[model samples]
Target chain A: QQQVRQSSQSLTVWEGETAILNCSYENSAFDYFPWYQQFPGEGPALLIAIRSVSDKKEDGRFTIFFNKREKNLSLHIKDSQPGDSATYFCAASGNNAGAKLTFGGGTRLTVRP
Target chain B: NSKVIQTPRYLVKGQGQKAKMRCIPEKGHPVVFWYQQNKNNEFKFLINFQNQEVLQQIDMTEKRFSAECPSNSPCSLEIQSSEAGDSALYLCASSPSGYEQYFGPGTRLTVL
Candidate 1:
C-alpha cells in the first residue's frame, strides 16, 4: 500500500499566481512532513517543513498548511515564478522512522510567462 | 552550499556487472539512508545507517545490495550482480534525527 500520496501528477500556473499541491499520508505515526524541490539534475533542496504540533509553516513564497486530524497537507506557492517550476516531493517520517523517508510520486509544476 | 554530496553523476554497467555508489552526508548528521527511484516503481526506500550500524533495510536490500558506512569515510551502497531491473537513480540522504532528511543529487544507474 502507498503510504503517502500526492494527488496531482503535474500542475501549471501563471506567474504570480498561487499553486496548491496536495498530499496525504496513511500512517498516523507520521510526525514530520517536509517538502523538497528538485531541478532537472540537481539534488532536492528543503523548501519547507512542519512538525505535527503546528498546523502551518510559511517561509518566503512557500507555505505548508497541515491538518493533522485529517492526515492531509497542502503546499501553497504564492507569487509562483518560473524559477519555482520543478518536481516537488512530499515526504514524511516519524520518531524511530529510521531516518528513511517515504516520498510521494512527485508533482511537476510549470509556471507560464 | 550542498551539504550532502554524491559522486559520479551517472553510471552505466552491463548486466551481471557490479555497480557502486557513494555518499557523503552533511557534517554532524548521524543517520544516512539510501533510496531508489525508478520510472516504473516510483520512489522506494532501501536502507539506512546510523554511525556504521544498520538501522533498517528492505528485503531487496538484504538480497542483492550491500551497504556500509566505514569509519571516517563516506558511505557506499553496492550491487553485487547488476540486473536491468536494478537500473534507477540511487539517492542518499542524511539527518540529525529520523525526521527530516536532506537528499543528494542522486546517481543514475543504467544497466545494459
Candidate 2:
C-alpha cells in the first residue's frame, strides 16, 4: 500500500497561472510533510515543508496548504514559469518513523510560456 | 546547488558483479540517508545513519547490500552481487536536524 498519494500523474498550466498539485496520506503518524522538485537526471531538491501544527506555508511563489484533519495537502505555484517545469514529490515522516521519508508517486508539471 | 557529492554519475555492471557507490554528506551534517529511485520514479528507502552509527535499514539492504559511514571518510553503499532488479538511481541526502534533508545529484546504476 502506498502511504503517500498524489492525485495527478501530470499537470499543465500556462505562464502566469497558478498550478495546484494535491497530495494525501494514509498514516496518521506522519507529522512532517515536505515537497521536493526534481529535474531530469538530478536528485530531488527540497522546495518547501510544513509541520502538522501549521495549516499553511509559503516560500516565494510556492505555497503549501495543508489540512491535517483531512490528511491532505496542496502545493500552489503562483506565476508559473517555464523554468518551473519538473516533477514534484510529496514526502511524509514522523518521529516514530525516525528521519526516513515515505514519498508519493510524484506529479510531472509543465508550464507553457 | 547541493553540497552533498556523489561520485560516478553513471555505472554499468554485469549481473553478479559487485557495484559500489559513494556519497559525501554536507559539512557539519551528521545524519545521512540512502534511497533507490527506479525508472518509474518510485523511491525506496535503503538505509540511514547518524554519524557513524546506523539508525535504520530495509530488509534488502540487510541482505545483499552493505553500507557504512566512517568517521572521516565518505559514506559507501556496496551490493554483494548485482542483479537486473538492482538497476536504479541511488540518492544520498544529509540533514542538519534530521527533519529536513538536502539531496545530491545521485548515481545511476545499470545492471545487465
Candidate 3:
C-alpha cells in the first residue's frame, strides 16, 4: 500500500493564478511533511516543509495547508509562473522513521504563460 | 550552487557488469542517504549512513548493492552485478539533522 498519495498525476494553471496540489498519507505516525520540487534531469529540491504542530506553512508564493487529523495536505502556489513548472513530490517522516522518507507518486505542474 | 556533489554524471554498463557511483555530502552533514529513481518516477530508498556507520538499508541494498561512507572519504554505492532493471538515476542527499535533507544532481546509470 502507498503510504503517501498525490491525487493528480499532472496539473495545469495559467500564469498569475493559484495552482493547488493535493496529497494524503496513510500512516498517522507521520509527523513531518515536506514537499520537494524537481526539474528535468535534476534532483529534487526542498520547496517547503511543515511539522504536524502547524496547520499551515507559507513561504512567498508557496503555501502548505496541512490537516493532521484528516491525514491530508495541499500545496498552493500563488501567482504561478512559467518558472514554477516542475514535478512536485510530497514526502513524510516521523519519530524513529529512520530518516527514510516516504514519497508520494508526484504531481507534474505546468504553468502556462 | 548545490552543496551535495555526485560524481560521474552518467554511466553505462552491460548486464552483469559492475557499476559504481560516488557522492560527497555537504560539509558538517553527518547523515548521508542514497535513493534510486527509476524511469517510472518512483523513488526507492537504498541506504544511509551516520558518520561512518550505516544506519539503515533496504532489501535491494542488502543483496547485490553495497555502500560505504568511510571516514574522511566520499561515500560510494556499488552494484555487484548490473541488471537491465538497475538503470535509473542515483541520488545522494545529506542533512545536518534529520527530516531536512538536501539532494545532489544525481548520477544517471544506464544498463544494457
Candidate 4:
C-alpha cells in the first residue's frame, strides 16, 4: 500500500500568491515529515521539514502545517515567485524503519509570473 | 561542497546489454541509497549501503541488479542484462542519519 499520498498532481499560482500543496499519510508511527523540491534534470533538494512533536515549521517563505490527529500535512509557499516552479515531494518515515522514506507521488507547482 | 555526484548523467543501451551507473556520495555521509523512478511518477526503492555494507534491498533489485561500494571508491550499480522495463532515472542519495537524504543528479538510463 502507498503509505504517503499527495492530493494534487499539479498546481499553478501567480507570482506573489500563495500555493498550497497537500499530503496525507497512512502510517501512524511516522514522525518525520519532509518536503523536497526538484528542478529539471536535477535531484530533489530539501526544502523544509517538520517533526511530529511540532504542529508547524516555518523557514523563509515556506511553511509546513502538520496535523497529527488527521495524519495530514500541507506545504504553503508564500510570495511565490517564478523561480519556485518545480516538482515537490512529501515524504514520511518512522523511528524503527531505519529512516527509509516513503515518498508521495509528488505535486508539480508552477509559479507563474 | 561538491555534494553527491553521479557519472554518465545519460546512458542508453540496447536490450540485453549491460548498463552501469556510478555514484559518489557527499563527504562525511555514511549511508547511501538508490531509488528508481518510472515514467508513471512512482519512486521505487532499490537498495542501500552503509559504508560498504548492504543494509537493505527490494526484491526487484536483488534479482537482476547488483550493486557494490568498494572502499574509497565510488558506488556502482550494474545490470547483468538490461531490459526495456529497466528504462528509468536511477537516483543515488546519501545521508548522515537517513532522515534527510541528499540526492545526486539522477542517471537516466534508456534501454532500447
Candidate 5:
C-alpha cells in the first residue's frame, strides 16, 4: 500500500496564477510533511514543509496547507512562474520511522507563460 | 543550492557487473540517506547512516547491495551484481537533524 498519495498526476496553470497540488497519507504516525520540487535530470529539492502542529507554512510564493486531522495537505504556488514547472513530491516521516521518508508518486506541474 | 555531492552522474553497467556510486554529504551533516528512484518516480529507501554507523536498511540492501560511510571518507553504495531491475537514479541526502534533508544531483545507473 502507498503510505503517501498525490491526488493529481499533473496540473497546469497560467503564469501569475495559483497552482494547487494535493496530497494525502494513510499513516497517522506521520508527523512531518515536506514538499520537494524536482527538475529533469536533477534530484528533488526541498521546497516547503510543515509539522503536524502547524496548519500552514509559507516560503516565498510556496505555501503548504496541512490538515493533520484529515491526513491531507495541499501545496499552493502563488504567482506561478514558467521556471516553476517541474515535478512535485509530497513526503512524510514520523518519529518511529526515524528519518526515512515515504514519498508520494508526484505531481507534474506546468506553468504556461 | 545543496552542498551534497554525488560522483559519476551516469553509469552504464552490463548485467551481472558490479556497479558502484559514491556520495559526499554536506559539511557538518552527520546523517546520510540513500534512495532509489525508478522510471515511474517511485522512491525506495535503501539505507541510512549516522556518521559511520548504519541506522537502517531495507532487505534488498542487506543482500546484494553493500554500503558504508567511513569516517572522513565519501559514503559508497555497491551492487554485487547488476540487474535490469537495479537500473534507477540513486539519490543521496544529508540532514542536519533528521527531519529536513538536502539532496544531491543523483547518479543514474543503467543496467543492460
Candidate 6:
C-alpha cells in the first residue's frame, strides 16, 4: 500500500501568486515530514521540513502547515517565481519507520511568467 | 549543490548482465539510503545502512541484488543479473541521524 500520498499530480500558478501543494499520509506513526524539490536532470533537494511538534514553519516565501490530527500537510510558496518550477515530493518517516522514507507521488509545479 | 555524490550518471546493460552503482555520502554523515524510482515517479525503498551495518532492505532475489556500505569506502549497490524491470533511476542519500537525508543525482539504469 502507498503510505504517503500527494493529492495533486500537477499545479500551475502565475508569478507572484501563492502556490500550494497538498499532501496526506496514512501511517499515523509518521512524525517527520519533508518536502523535496527536483528540477529536471537533477536530484531532489530538501526544500522544507516539519516535525509533528510544530503546526507550522516558515522560511522566507516557503511555509509548511501541518495537521497532525488530520494526517495532512500543505506547502505554501508565497510570491512564486518562474524559476521555482519543479517537481515536489512529500516524504514521511518516524522512529518505527526507521531510516527508510515513504515518499508520495510527486506534484509537478509549473509557474508562468 | 548536493553534498552527496553518485557515480556513473547513466548505465545501460543487457538482460542478465551485471550492473553496479556507487555513492559517496556527505562528510560526517553515518547513514545512507538507496531508492529506486520508476518512470511514473514511484519510489521504492531498496536498502539503508548506518556506518557498516545494514538497517533495512527490501525482499528481492538475494543473488541478484546486493548492497554494502564499508568504512572509509563509498557505498555500492550491485545487480548480478539485470532484468528489464530494473530499468529505473537509483538514488542515494545520506543523513547524520536518518531524520533528513540529502540526495545525490540519480543514476539512470536501462536494461535491454
Q: What C-alpha lDDT do the candidate models reach, one value each? A: 0.89, 0.95, 0.94, 0.90, 0.95, 0.92
Tens digits of lDDT, candidate 5, B13-39? 999999999999999888999999999
Off by over 4 Å in 4: A96-98
Give the interface RMSD of each candidate.
2.2, 1.8, 1.9, 2.3, 1.7, 1.9
| TM-score head-to-head 1 vs 3, winner | 3
Q: Is the docking of candidate 2 incorrect, acceptable, medium or high quality?
A: medium
Q: Between candidates 2 and 6, which one is better according to lDDT? A: 2
Q: Ranking by lDDT, best first?
A: 2, 5, 3, 6, 4, 1
| DockQ winner, 2 or 6 | 2
- Candidate 4 per-residue lDDT, tens place, B1-112, comes to 2399998899999999999999999988888889898877688888988889998898877778999988899999998899999999999999888777889999999999
Chain B TM, cand. 1: 0.95
lDDT of 2 by residue, A43-94 (tens): 9999999999999999999999999989999999999999999999999999
**lDDT, residue A7, model 3:** 98
lDDT of 2: 0.95
Worst lDDT 10-window in candidate 3 chain B = B93-102
lDDT of 5 by residue, A1-113 (tens): 99999999999999999999999999998999999999999999999899998999999999999998899999999999999999999999996434799999999999999
**Candidate order by decreasing DockQ:** 5, 2, 6, 1, 3, 4
Query: Which segments of candidate 1 are over 4 A away from where they belong?
Result: none
- Each prediction's DockQ? 0.64, 0.69, 0.62, 0.56, 0.69, 0.68
Give the DockQ of candidate 2. Answer: 0.69
Off-target runs (Cα >4 Å) in candidate 3 are none
Task: List candidate 6 stretches off by more than 4 Å.
Answer: A96-98, B61-63
TM-score of 3: 0.98
lDDT of 1 by residue, B1-112 (tens): 4589997789999999999999999998888999998864388889999889999999988888999998799999999999999989899988887667888999999999
Model 5 residue A32 CA deviation in Å? 0.7
Error of 4 at B67 (Å): 0.9
Write model 6 residue lDDT over B11-48, tens digit each, in one string: 99999999999999999988899999999999988999
Q: Which stretches of candidate 2 lie over 4 Å from their true place?
A: A96-98
